[model samples]
Target: MPRLSGCAFFSDKIMQAKVDLLHTGAEAMFADLGHFSKKAIQIAFLSSIYPSLVLTYAGQTAYLINNVNDFSDGFYKFIPRPVYWPMFVIATLAAIVASQSLISATFSVIKQSVVLDYFPRVKVVHTSHQKEGEVYSPEINYILMVLCVGVILGFGGGKEIGNAFGVVVIMVMLITTIMLTLVMIIIWRTPPVFVGMFFIPFVIMEGSYVSAVFTKIPEGGWLPFAVSMILALIMFVWYYGRQRKIEYEMANKITMERLGQLLAMPEVQRVPGLCFFYSNIQDGLTPILGHYIKNMSSLHTVTIFVTLRYLLVSKVDQRERVLIKRLGPRGVYQCTVQYGYADNLSLKGGDDLVAQVMRCLKRHIAMSTDRRSSVSTEEEIANLEAASLAGVVHVRGKMRFYVGDDAGCFDKVMLRSYEFLHSICRSALPALGMPLQQRVEIGMLYKV
Candidate 1:
């Protein structure tokens, strides 16, 4: 697939700044939470609750019917009470909670763009904040409360309300799964092969389970499935077109040798280190050097920044992070460096980017050097200090979308994208994926 630059954005200002270990706010947050342990806890909690609730609801109607049949037919006929009503109620509640939470979380996931300014500004309250007795969504809360009161008075209980819950739950799960896939690809920089092999399959399987339930349920169960399918179709078309549009916009900037040269210039010149380059590409192909260079130049070095989110799966090709590709007289392609959307640091939660880049670049260069070696720590420090004082360079350009309207969306997308490229330039070698070049340092040009 051809990659596209969303727009044209470039700058030529350079700042000699220090580089540090902490790359972005999210990284800092993950670090502060002590990393894996916090994530493990979250995964564990979600795993425990999600499947249990889904399964509990799936067989509920069947259990209700079997128990009702066991009771005397005359007893139910005379008073008309189902033996499994209680179980049915409990199962319905469980499903609603799980599915409702899923829907709310979908909103949160999309809201990240809003937080990142990829979308228009809107207020969103964190659920935890509301749980602590804060009036977060006053309008929504009051509307729900009043409707619930109306239902109680009208039906004596939630019989009518309960009937509609199953359909709502199923619709939400399907929609959420679809949304999750899009988010993973667009924002998280998830590889298409991995997403297709592992993630999409799981979603299809879960959807099948939900589908079976809808097929078997007695009270308008199929309604939810129909709605989910309709919504899914609409979203699929919208998202697919959007992606195609973005790619078309970014096409001119996705050159292989050009990007490789951009990465090499700062390091090869050794002109005080910090350098920042920006591009208006949505895919961050510039951020991901391995994929970009491999296709363009056929020079494979250890791709220190290979997308590692799917390392375990087998069918997917496993290229080492550090693949050494020869450039003949140009010398070995020391580091096949590419930076993309995910690597962009400018979108990080409010950070002093210039200072952060300075610190990060210094640390990156230092991490490679051994103090006990010939170079004294004092001298290395002096060099780093001098580099920072020299200031980094910034390159900016006006990216014109090769396709579609020139609304601000194109510029907004590209500017943020370029900023991200700058951020990656500011930071150290990426920590995940294929190993990066040990012999060469990808210098950052820091700018404020």
Candidate 2:
């Protein structure tokens, strides 16, 4: 079971030594030891094959002889040359094979970690992997298959396809460098002084080299530009749509105050007490977590609560801000931290944020003035009652018993505040399937 944030110090003391032992043992057995030697050997074998073929085909024997002949005949007297343009072609093939192997291996490691939730997901696998830990990729394999077939079909007929591959790849690298620099400024929050010192100079140098390469080889530019444009369009549509959906979800959730109140409940206090719960407010509170918390019957000393803000915006400034407060036993201090990003951000490796929160809970409570509006207090209750003379039940705050299917305690708590939700839906819609003002009507229920 996950330990509560407050008492985790004790748990950590007891478990740290064991955890260290396991980590050291795993490294020795799996990372440093010869357990993965077989895989390495396979990688080496594949890397070596094409390079050997390319070298051999290039007439290494004749090339050496020609060099010697040139030196002996006083350079200018060297007239005859053995044809080996085929070697250039072979070398290109060899380079492509080598690049693919390396790319596949890197992505394979990434893919395993991502699917298992050991790390944040990225576009590591363009295709499939056969085994859980295998480095082979189906995407790479298919791409290779297509290239090989193309090579066979266009053999000696169209070298442009082969030539285009290298040129386009270089163009991609240049574009990537530009994108990386921009990302560092926007996402990394790197200081402008350092960014200018490093970024401006590096861009100047790299951009010049990239421009020179493209100018020297114009065909490379057009093809890569076309492909890049297509990819940019796809990404824009995908990311923009996703951001809108996430925003819609967060806006409809309970206020930050109620969330903090929920964390203070007796049932919520038993589990390794989480101070804050960050989710895509639309996901609301997870029913499973709520059920476990409600069932836990222990008391914990320290806690910090959170509700994460995951938003994808074109600009980072559009991100949400955090709200923090101290609730003080049975209702100690609590905080909410919010952040925005233009892309998906991972929580791993971000340090012990909850620990920092625990300290804030003990000493301070910094939240927005707007928080009171979101949370329902005694005044809100009277207003709610006045608005509902149709005998609508008005439940508010920690004392309220949320009514919903035991969808789990967390979700139930969230749904309870939405009591007017179902009524509103019934009054607004004529039929379940019928259109509702150009809107896609979801159920009043919020499921995590």
Candidate 3:
């Protein structure tokens, strides 16, 4: 039961993952196309095909004199040699296509999880410049390859893998049903009676699949559980440690007066071009900015502290996605970009983030009535254009953990585990879609 406890991962692990409305709709449309297309095919022609296939299978089962139990053998017995061979070939092609779809879905789902911050940063390479969605993750790919090799070694045949796959498919369906019921009662406010009407049959159907596959745990069914548990452990540990770090940052951040002093300091000279100080913190400057001004000894002409947050809804309106607030007169701004779990970030399709930030800041400047009326619209645009020509840079703080000097034994152990897990997690740079040359990463060590 403890090992099987990984069943919880199917839902809980994906809780942080965003499911955008457009992607959801596309998936649903394709699902419907598959479902009704099959239904239509059955109704129009497969009705006859089904009866014949059933008879063929039944006849093979009935024949005690049957030389073989294999489907190809069965087909050879019932159908013409040439026709049976082609049928087998066609079936194989169909299976490969189906498997390709599954593989593609796996990549997309994991990428989505990374976006939603469920997983740590991983290398995501766009395989096609023209096709925005065509991406490849080497880390996930290698992990999958190893797992598949292990599965082939353990299962020894496609039939065993397929049997386990059937169990997983049913389990996912059951989980989807359970989640749907909750969504109905909560989000959609469906009546209890209607919820019961929708889920009862599925519960029975999927529960039967559970029974069928539960016994096969010893027969390679435990593969997914093992894999999921390992993945879930890595995911949760990274997320928990990162959350703790952010909490630390929030609790110990510089006060408003202190931040004002730092920004207005004589050493904080405004250089040409723009700088993006990326942080999860919404209030008070991230400690890294303090480090930057002290160590780097200067600030950008335009410094916008950008924080990306996930909103509760499915998608934020394009106009409302980026919220801009000018913090002080030191060319500092706070830009919080909100994205729904299911919504794509504004930086999608190779959009220039620096340009977007400038636009948001311009909009803010235009709306503010308290600003001096001396600077006209043309001048404001010219300043932005000048900065755009000067180029842009992204700055992020990378934190490492150490046990606190006054820490207890438990704290030391916990900090050790945290650092170990954190080390294995992906770096933020690759995930942020920032070019290596333009990105500046500042390191900070936290005694936890």
Residue-by-residue lDDT tens digits, candidate 1, 97-196: 5444444434444345433434332334443321211113333345446755765576564333343344454445566678888898999988899778
Mind giving the per-residue lDDT tens digits that candidate 3 earns over 1-448? 8655545433342221111110111222233232234566546435654565467556666652555555344535755567878878877885565555555556766766777777767776555434334556788788778877888897898656755664466567678889998999999999899999998988875565566566666665677677778888767766777677887788678665776787687876778887888887787878767777778778787778888775545557778888887675546678988765445443335455555667777877777766544667667657766766798788888877767678787566655666886678675533446767787889887766
Cα displacement (Å) at residue 204, model 2:
6.5
Error of 3 at 73 (Å): 7.1
* Number of the predicted model whose lDDT against the real structure is largest: 3
* Model 2 C-alpha lDDT per residue in residues 388-432, reported as the tens digit of each score: 232211111111123446566644443443332222222211111
Number of backbone collisions per candidate: 66, 17, 4
Candidate 3 — worst ten consecutive residues by lDDT sum? 16-25
Off-target runs (Cα >4 Å) in candidate 3 are: 1-80, 123-139, 197-201, 264-274, 294-301, 308-323, 336-352, 355-367, 372-393, 405-438
- The 10-residue segment with the lowest total lDDT in model 2: 391-400
Deviation from truth (RMSD, Å), model 1: 20.2
- Tally clashes: model 2: 17
Top candidate (TM-score): 3
Instruction: Estimate the TM-score of every prediction.
Output: 0.31, 0.33, 0.69
Task: Please tell me which model should have the higher lDDT, number 2 or number 3.
Answer: 3
